[model samples]
Target: MTSPLTRNEQNSKSRAQTFGIRPDLFQAAQDHMVKKSDLDELSENLANAGVRGFTAATLPQNIHLGSPDSGTADYAILPFTDRYGPAVAAHPEPPSLQIEESGLWTVTLNLGTAGHGLAPAGSGFFEVSIYVGPEQPAGGPVRQYDFFNWRVELDHQQSFATTFTVDFVVESPGDFIYVQVSGMRGRAIEGDYTRTRLSVRKTDNRTR
Candidate 1:
């Protein structure tokens, strides 16, 4: 079977008369995805090609950057899993990180999926990265990863905590900051998008 994203892409072409997904148009929005709670949606986005139909990750995650800003969902973006159905991915939705005004802040990713927390508990080829910064096209380095090769193991009913206690300086405040948590599904790697909540506890640039 082909990958969900691949299938979705094909569906877009085959079903162009009915459903049209401009996933490429909203690729920038993916950068905003980030919340440690659940990243199933982000993973699915990589699988599905109907992201434009859904809201892209944005700051103040509570508001979906499109119509229905007052929707009851507390996420900046929703993959609309109910509409398009499930993809062969880790979650029904993508990562939900928050980003309101860029700056140096702390980030903590908690693996909530007990069973398939990503890479099947011991695939031994998973990595996680949190990119922070303003919007970039689809595939540009935003901030950077906390770990070089981070992996998520079987939580066994516990949360896997990976903290990035470092400084992330953005070009401007409220510059569409975000956290990109990506992992590998076997050989094909995908990313989870989320909006990050950034903070600043001002100190000298060099105050060791």
Candidate 2:
């Protein structure tokens, strides 16, 4: 004849069965059987594995181009229309990326444009530049042009459709990244209803 199981033993078995954990291996039975230690371990492992996150922003239609008198280097607010329609017209609030993870992050700047016919037939030229800096204030001096920048050019012969791209790495957390469009000339950008986009994300070199 076998003796019936005690109340404590019954509850332990019940919790283990419900949680799909072995009763013999499940040690935390009192004051909640779910182990906090196990959860903490899982989270730590995930962080060490280098989980990645990213965000993207698109140029707004009819972006304010600084007057030609101000020159391309002058400060001009480039509005951005989010993935959807509406518009993010607020100043200093243009699309930006807030880094939270410390790893190798990449920023890809893309611009698409069409000839504005500003120049004579077969004589047009379009130029645009992207600038990036670390935690740069809304209005900072252009003397710090060394952060990172790239310029794309299209002449009458190459004016149909143009896309420019630039890639670089960010190695610290709490670092903020933004874009500035400059050195634009010749024809206007193509996306009037929509506009170019900038994307920032993390990448693991070991996996490459």
List, residue by residue over 69-131, the lDDT tens digit for candidate 2. Answer: 443323343444354322221112354555555556566656655544333344422334455
Q: Which predicted model would earn the best lDDT? A: 2
Q: Which regions of candidate 1 fall more than 4 Å away from where they truly are?
A: 1-104, 117-122, 136-162, 184-208
Write candidate 1's Cα lDDT for 104-204 as tens digits: 43333322221222223333322344444344324434443322335554322232333344454443433332333333232221122222222223222
The worst-scoring run of ten residues by lDDT in candidate 1 lies at 71-80
CA-lDDT, candidates in order? 0.32, 0.50
TM-scores of the candidates are 0.30, 0.51
Candidate 2, superposed: residue stretches over 4 Å from native: 1-51, 64-77, 81-95, 120-128, 137-146, 156-167, 184-186, 192-195, 204-208
Candidate 2 lDDT at 50 equals 62
Native-to-model Cα distance after best TM-score fit, residue 110 in candidate 2, in Å: 2.2
